[model samples]
Target: IDVDKSVDLTNCDREPIHLLGHTQGFGCFIALRFDWIIAYSSANTNDYFGADSDDVIASPLKNWIDPQTLHDIRSAYQASTITGRNERLFSRAIEATGVPVDISIHHNGTFIIIEFEKITDDRVPEDSFVRSMLSQFHRYSDSQELINSTAQYIQFLTGYDRVMVYQFLPDGAGEVIAEAKNENIDSFFGLRYPASDIPKQARALYLKNLLRVIHDVDSEPVPILPEAEDAEDSIDLSFSTLRAVSPIHIEYLKNMGVKASMSVSLIINGKLWGLIACHHYSPLIPSYFVRTELELFAEVFSLELSSRLMREREDESNRVRNVHNQVMASIGSEGSLLGLLEKQFDTMRALIQCDGIGAVIDEDYRTAGTALSADWVHQLTRYLNRQASSEVITVDSLEKVLKNYDTSSDKIAGVLAIPVSKSPRDYLLFFRMAQTQTVNWAGNPEKPVSFGPNGSRLIPRSSFALWQQTHDDRCEHWSDVDVRSGDSLRVTLLEVIIRHFQERSELQS
Candidate 1:
């Protein structure tokens, strides 16, 4: 009987019956004695006949077995079975049959856990797996929740620490969208990293190596193929999995206090959207089988997220196209134009994920929009005039460009400037919360002190709460990207606001 039990075989009750056990299952056989006993991957039990030998399987078990009885059993079994000339040979032939038990024992009573090899999808239809995965995505597409349900589903499929959906700005800065993580871990939902954190070179590299796993940052190095050194651009995976942890990156992670890292790229419309970062508390090297499984899962997630985003953007673009036509018809009517253009702020707010929404646009190209505050308007007008002069304009760092602006107002930390039309003249401006907030973390701000080979002391990390000195900084603590599904509540509220603007624009126009 090809009996298969999910529980460890050694833990099963085979009492009162003499048993022949091998490898991990040998423990059960040790509790009973039969007329004749045949064991493999087991140790002699003379030292503690009544005691468990699970801890000392490394030593020979020959001491416990009666030599004459063992010899007789070996001769009889070999004669009856005619399996092979030697016990080791028989074990090898059995293992070649792809049976798990073969790896559990050898005739000499030694145990060896065969290095698990690869699992090919050829044994299972690839199309069926992909189709099954797509079926899982249906729940997300059918929902109206603004939270990154797409990211959440991916996290479920791939067992990784908080699978976060991160949005990367052109300058390398990024924000977390959705995340799910271990309950004990403190969230990094709203934390922001400077553009320098992910340099241009790193971003480019991600395009080709879409998935990466850095397990056991402190593990010993596995050298590459010595003969392949002459090939300049060759990628050798032979021993890459065993490569040593990078010193530079170790220091980088130590600075961030991240022990393990795995990342999958999210591409939308052939553009980089963000990444799904999986973190671990200790060294965790996943086998190739697990890595492939995650990659397959991530690919499905990227496709779904891209498809959904494209559909939504298409709907918005179509609405905008129709609305623009209506606004043209009512160009002379200021109230109609105001209603038609009122949604500009809402759209900008959605894209940037801001707290406050405000816009400045000309009524028939006449006046600017309402001022957030008297001081805010003054700074905005000057910035708008500067935008008018540039033929081709794109604002990368609004904080740096708008330094003269009064960002000190309320919770406004960032601004979104969008040109209303192809013409570069005075255009629309939106205000909102900046991605990075000023916070006063509870612990020491300085990085941990380090002791070098020569015992040199290192400085600790910075923990000053200086970023949160003002009222604006206390508004929100963004979650790490993957765990932001709970933030759907905010997105739902914004959807209503967006609907209001869409209705007013259509009706008033």
Candidate 2:
């Protein structure tokens, strides 16, 4: 259905970007050899030092930094994992004019990299305020509430027009679960964004870099110069604060009528759970101080969010455990297999929150609730059981995974099939109806990636006409809570069946 299983994402993750020989305009990066000679630098050296890119080449790194500052950096770089040193200065006449520069130093194995970013934000959000903000976050009882509050607080803190908590779903796609927007901005709440928006490699980098900000989307990117001789030797800007973004991403933002953007990663247990995406109608560059505070807030928020999610899972598990008990009780007092199941049909259906529930014993069927005809049920069950493992078989899209099924006639898009006994092919299947969702795509989701005049490289979509399309025959995904119920049901039913069969065998003997 809406599950796109065939599209090639080859370009999404393999975008060899750090070698693009450039950086963003806000900062200038320098790579130095151990002997203090400049090895590589962004071509836009004029922005910071008013020197040609080559001016840094063969020049002692000391010339760019005062002796005291150089000594501090050397001490900090002694350990690879000690964390980098960050200090700011009112750089008087270091370049065309006096401005604030946030200087940073770190080592990347091959080279000692230094970066200078022009800072505009003079004052960061205060510590007391951060604590108060965090205290308010703890007041929230659930993850969704915490995220919703985070969206509002981030938008308020950063002064962006809109902020959204875009949570990734099981299948690469994502949904905006929480959003806070200015009165004039459009609502993106509940809108599902395809995985193509954020490719796999980009996601990996988000874990490494907490904050990615683009002050001016239209500004040209600074290129890295003295092009790296070998692609492998190219700097992996996976950690670069000013790493240039992919051209396609810039175009994608432009089409959405956004001028500036920032994303703060929401990392849960070291993996990215979502992003706090901020968008502005005009260019907005929060100072390094403000961004630093944002990063701290994001890290703390991640820990808080993790705690809330764990609580939710615990609550769900308890509910499932209770359902497990009731289902076992019904099966344990069995008369006829079909009659016992039919009596507890409501409980079984609620266990997974499906459109219908079905049971097939051997080649025959006994079912309750909305389901396909007996013949179709048998066919679907046989097909799913073959592809299934000992664990629960979860199908979000029957058509995509089971190619032999008649897609046109099937109203059930997803199925959770569990085997109670395989000898007679007894199965308890939960079915979900196709949920045709609506999406307001920035461009046609179907034509998300196109080609430029060269007709080789993938380009961003050319349109932003508020394209609305009904997603394919997909259903609300089965959550872990639902699967837990199935797991309990399978174990309980299997035990009862084995015991009953043993008693029958003993009587016959």
Candidate 3:
């Protein structure tokens, strides 16, 4: 654990978070076998239930709960087993403590985990409020507006100091697309954070558990009783609501001056898209009912966001398809491939979103718009022929991939090259001009380590002041839609080439 020697940024990803063998102090945890015998219990369970861990272990769960409550627990366990999702019971009073608690139940491979937190608020959101939010979402055709409204609504509902829509970029890094915060606090909107900030394993856990809350970052973690000697064999708390926070993550929040925080995952197409991250300046824990409401809101928001994105992509695709059809029609009537391309190069450039277009068929090479010199095009084609294997090649920075070319004064930064034929090594190339962007980060992404209370281990940076960075020699990345369009054009051009060969053969015959 020596920060100066063994610990580095990568250690964050290697941390065994799921086997932490602890729970937050505000809640208690109990794990039972399918046969209803207790297998594991939190060390602080007696503080709420007044039963010792030694006595609780190896005992039937029915010994603690009334018959009716036991039946409800069984039913909930059955439902969870059927659906492969967590089941919950809200505002149920335990027989031993007579305290109303919110219970969450889920099963891992070997045990069924039940977590209990004392109920502080029982009010559910009004039906009208939720309906109004849904109505507002439908009214906005733009995704940015929708996301902004979502952040505002969440801040209002949770009474958090700040709420942000943290979106994962094409690269592993994240950007704050929208923000709602108190006037006193500085805005984090449009700020970027490196991928290492939230390591790969942490992102994976977020996918498994949709919502996470840290009531108080400064509170001590309650250990699980009968701690395993081997860390590898410790209890798996992947889905536990009361799972202890990672020490590194706690240090991170402390550095940000955050006392409490919560995040709800935004999932699209079964992949983790981003997070609705909330920050509180002081310790705060929302009631279970309210947290559930927030979960529902996030779910609806994800669906709406996914729909809007898909619709936008479809609109762009339709526009490209129209241009493609026009080009194909002209080629069919003109009965020439390269000739038609040369004549209608302007229209062909509009088929995909790019600054320039080029085509290499056998020996003849042609280009249009802001393209490279003929020699450069020929060299690019040769490079593509050597690197590509019947698939499209996309590069956002030509300098990084293509060598021997003087890129110091190169105007074109990106390329999407599609191979049309293998024999002649013909290609259809799309080019994009270089662009410069200024990015504001919360802190220096390069320097995320510092010595802290826990010896020389790596800790979060102490300051979150704005750190500006300028990026150069890159272009707007070619999106999936662009790749699809390029592939479609390649297929149609291949068809046209085959048809011309067939017609010439018939004439010769």
User: 1-509, model 3: which lDDT tens digit per residue?
Assistant: 11244444566788888999989988888999879999889988786677988988888887877788788888898898887777888878778877677888888778998888886654553343566678787677688899998899889878999999999977667899999999999898988786667888989999978888999999999888889998799899888888899898898899889999999999998889999999999998877666777777778889999999998888877877787677667654444566766776777677677888887777688888776667777777777777848878887877776676544476777789888777778877788876433346567445544677755555655222111122346666777777888788777777767766776777779
TM-score winner, 1 or 2: 2
CA RMSD of all predictions:
17.6, 4.7, 5.6
Arrange candidates by lDDT, highest first: which order?
Answer: 3, 2, 1
TM-scores, one per candidate: 0.49, 0.83, 0.77
Error of 2 at 364 (Å): 5.5
Candidate 1 per-residue lDDT over residues 280-392, each given as its tens digit: 77764443444555556666666766667778867755554444444334333234333545534344344334444443444233222322454554565567666654322
For model 1 the local lDDT of residue 189 reads 75
Clashes of each: 30, 8, 0
**Superposed Cα RMSD, model 3:** 5.6
- Greater-TM-score candidate between 2 and 3: 2
> Who is ahead in lDDT, 1 or 3?
3
| Tens digit per residue, CA lDDT, model 2, 404-463 | 665347677788888877655677888877655323333455544444542353444432
After TM-score superposition, the amount by which residue 124's alpha carbon in candidate 3 deviates from its true location, in angstroms, is 8.1
User: What local distance difference test score does each model get?
Assistant: 0.41, 0.72, 0.79
Instruction: Indicate the worst ten consecutive residues by lDDT in candidate 3.
Output: 462-471
Which portions of model 1 miss their true places by more than 4 Å? Answer: 1-131, 142-161, 223-245, 255-258, 319-406, 409-428, 433-509
